[model samples]
Target chain A: MSLTPSKRAYVPFVSVEHMMGLVHHIGIEQVLTDLASEIEADFRRWPLFDKTPRVASHSDVGVIELMPTSDGETYGFKYVNGHPKNTAEGLQTVTAFGLLAEVDSGYPTLLSEMTLLTALRTAATSAMAAKHLAPKGARTMAMIGNGAQSEFQCLAFKAVCGIDTVRLYDIDTSATTRCAGNLAANGLTVVECRSGQEAMEGAQIITTCTADKQYATILTDNMVGSGVHINAIGGDCPGKTELHRDILLRSSIFVEYPPQTRVEGEIQQLEHDHAVTELWKVIEGQVSGRTDDRQITLFDSVGFAIEDFSALRYIAKAVKGTPFFTELDMIADPDDPRDLFGMFQRAKS
Target chain B: MSLTPSKRAYVPFVSVEHMMGLVHHIGIEQVLTDLASEIEADFRRWPLFDKTPRVASHSDVGVIELMPTSDGETYGFKYVNGHPKNTAEGLQTVTAFGLLAEVDSGYPTLLSEMTLLTALRTAATSAMAAKHLAPKGARTMAMIGNGAQSEFQCLAFKAVCGIDTVRLYDIDTSATTRCAGNLAANGLTVVECRSGQEAMEGAQIITTCTADKQYATILTDNMVGSGVHINAIGGDCPGKTELHRDILLRSSIFVEYPPQTRVEGEIQQLEHDHAVTELWKVIEGQVSGRTDDRQITLFDSVGFAIEDFSALRYIAKAVKGTPFFTELDMIADPDDPRDLFGMFQRAKS
Candidate 1:
């Protein structure tokens, strides 16, 4: 039977540039601040999530991953690729996009680029951990990996935890120079450190976002002082790590989804029973965070799907007033659900 | 450090019509034949592949699914949705797309629409199963549920089996008329039948593809005669069944992935040890398909990822020599795998 002529179809989409414009339009400071709050809020209600470790398809050159998580009512997943050797071939090592769909109908509500969103969430997650686990009155941060993620980290700390200065260091001097140029003398007292050791000195928060797809000790125990909160961002897959073993042992480590962290985050080198605290437990008052001010603390940040969920949720809200977004023909909208084949003739494209 | 000049930026996407046009240009008959060969080849080496039950996300009105499979060097996943009630609202009951990527790089090499491809593969899979299972010299066929896929079923049988005529029936008379008209003046003889019983008279191959998403006894024991080959296609999800318990009891059952078939196929109504054979065994010559000419053979067909993989593989070959296709920006071309952010600025989307 022919489908009725009157029908409605929706193509909901948000492009990369439109999403970035929305971030700028709403002020990055406010965005990061709110993002941390959303992450923290979602984490506190952690029991609501159906948590499964990400399903990863690893390769010799890199890894492509699908991270799916649901809070029973909403389902979300991110399709991301991490190819460390891509930069040599003029490609970005990490590129991502994700979808947020309704659990009841499985209809995609928002499909958007997550490359920029990922940067925002990583920074937000780091700051969210710092807020619960870092010592009060922490004012400075040591950004060890001054690459694409540096600007977002600097801004996240500034907007969320009142950090006013950042000391940056990278193996490439050009990366450090470029990071500083993007900062453009904006508020934070930028110090271009010659080494990771130099960057960690006299810092309250140490954030590492290095991109090597190998086991790298970006921070050794000697470089990290007592009471410093290490926000280890890189070393996010198997056969990759950032902080040295001794550093992890000494600090009271707090992590997001410990099971996943043990495989992809800095804690991968440690034992299964190596006592660690979940950040959500502390945020929800289920467990204590930063029990002693002088105690060294660490946030083993392996990116989680929920943070991306929160990031997508935040973007949908922040970009509400903008007309920069365009829709993609992702879902089939037919005149009659039973007659799917009729769709081909109705929508020729 | 600006990534403004990175050479790893690309956005090549083939639209929906281009894919269909490519399929049409390649000729439908060739795709079916090549797909049959691919399915047969994959089924033979079934043990080498890592197979898992499909992960389904069900909803009130439909289900969105991700069927993932890999063979060490390549990874493929299909995103498909089945909404039987969608046509009432002018939406497709099913819409699908999938990706094929290199296992070494986790980079997607091909991204193609699977809505049409699915129709082709489903029919090809049925015919492939019938080749080994159906009794000798099966000519006339009874096709239950004449919808969009009716034409493919008729053609695949004519090509794979030596079927000379089709006896069709549908609850909706218009659908039956459409099927008859499409088959008219095209090689095979077409006849309209008043009921499922009427369609099965003298027909050796009885295909049941009714769209009711529930337990339906479309084929009763009395209607299913000796030497009848039942191709049950529509009973593909949980709570969906087509054959009566008695029909299944008297017939020899065959399936694709027993674990999944237990939940989604016609055997969902049967006991755990109902004694079904995997189609791979038959294709590989490891097991006997049909023992006697008078024995009732039933193929409880639930489409699998490998079949989709076979179809996608076949399509890639079919379009290899033609310039009728375009590529999607499914993967990034980064000079430095770490500089994914810089490529966004250069994407020219």
Candidate 2:
């Protein structure tokens, strides 16, 4: 029996640098547009997925998690961490990576840095939610918390929802300046607002992407206008939230997966019996979405594995034609399936 | 505060070869014996564990799976693949690896090759069951499948249960010869038998670990003698059974994690309500063990993530003094935790 590494043994891994380059090349808006479609397509066939909330390993300072999903054929999982203190030491508060593999031979097909992709996908998911949940003709957006993810959120709304005006606010005026500065090249009108209230004025879509790991409220009920869509992003973990309880109570909430969103999203403040709709059901046409033009709609945007799965698929396609992929020796090739011991014995320590 | 790479970084990873070397250095028998205790210690606190069956991605030729579990403080997961046809092309039917992380920080503290460790843990778990379930004075073991895992299973029984005689049988005589040859230095009386019945004669334990992806009976109803303990390892997946239905009906079956074993273990053929005791209950002294010498005890050993967790712990300890460890760039350290984009902007693509 002849045993050799298959000609198809290479698994392309996208590093943080490589992924960033790809994102830079495609431009953030294009990436978000493509990712939105990918996420929508995957969510349509939700029954084929073996879905579960990520298995998280939380540390005192932060959290590390593995989010896995399978579509009966291909399996995908992401390794991500969120450490608010990491920023104090010059490390990003959130870093991530992911793997995709074949179910049959257990061969890894792709390994990619998900840090950048997470930012992109989060923005895409927010835009997707706003598309279905936002009021019709929503052209103005308020982006509170102008940090690493704020730029992507602005561009996604601009590219996907035809929002021409983006109002930015942050405790750090420099962050707002930087966010507005980036959008300078994107041909969108940018307003560097002084407070959340200023940014929310006349804005149809409001996004909160703050990085603080606390229960601090960036949005109050008085700041919200009628018929506004709220994209709550930063209130992901147990102690973190963006909108005040009063704001959430006033809005009709939608979530990625309710069981998970109940703990990590803004809905953590709500009672278990409180009603909410899963975004997929809305996309699947199983539930009504944003029935009235003046109704408040909230997309409690705690990220999900399916979105990462979608992002991985998007990047895999995006990197296919570029030199932005690296390969890793992630799996084994044994000459004789019975000779597992022999394979181990032959490998170098 | 100066945070250097050395202060925060662990060693590089221990690859498949390094793990095999550690096993050979410590001797497989000793590793399995130690693993038996580790598993017992964890199993005693089984209620604290959050258990779930692995999330599998199935393909036409094989399957890849991610198995995850947590005990509130620590979280662990294993990535594994099973490709029956891989052996024909020189790949082992199974290849695996896993990680252990602290629950608080979500940092992966340990990453090790589980390919070799899986074999060791499977053997350890079987011996653990045999320690309490096998008939007293069970010395002679009949090994029906003399493949790569055969030696480990035999030696584990030897080290854990004082089995001094191993009666070997396989459809391929060379496999039996190889098993005997590998165990020559272990000082056991190795008997080569032509058939399963011949191998079972006077043997107190029968271990069936054949790799055929079919319902191939390595043990028939007539072959299992009274008071014999059976370790059924190969019948781990659906439609994969090594024992006749009547044999399982006659034996007092004990299992690891019932939800999993019901789908993958030897008792998958049995009726849904077939009585089986969880091995942990027996370990905790909550349940009675082998009541009489005439009773047949069967360990429906569908391997669980906890055993892998324990095995990863065992190997980590064994390699503590050795240079067989390596760390991967699995996690990220962003300079300025809030500025995740800067990492990408500055990183060399």
lDDT of 1: 0.77
**Predictions' DockQ, in order:** 0.38, 0.35
What TM-score should be assigned to candidate 2?
Answer: 0.84
Please give the C-alpha DockQ score of model 2.
0.35
Which of the CAPRI classes, incorrect, acceptable, medium or high, describes model 1? acceptable
lDDT accuracy of residue A273 in candidate 2: 77
Clashes of each: 36, 29
Q: Indicate the residue-level lDDT of A140 in model 1.
A: 87
What TM-score, computed on C-alpha atoms, does each candidate reach? 0.88, 0.84
> Every model's Cα RMSD, please?
3.7, 4.3
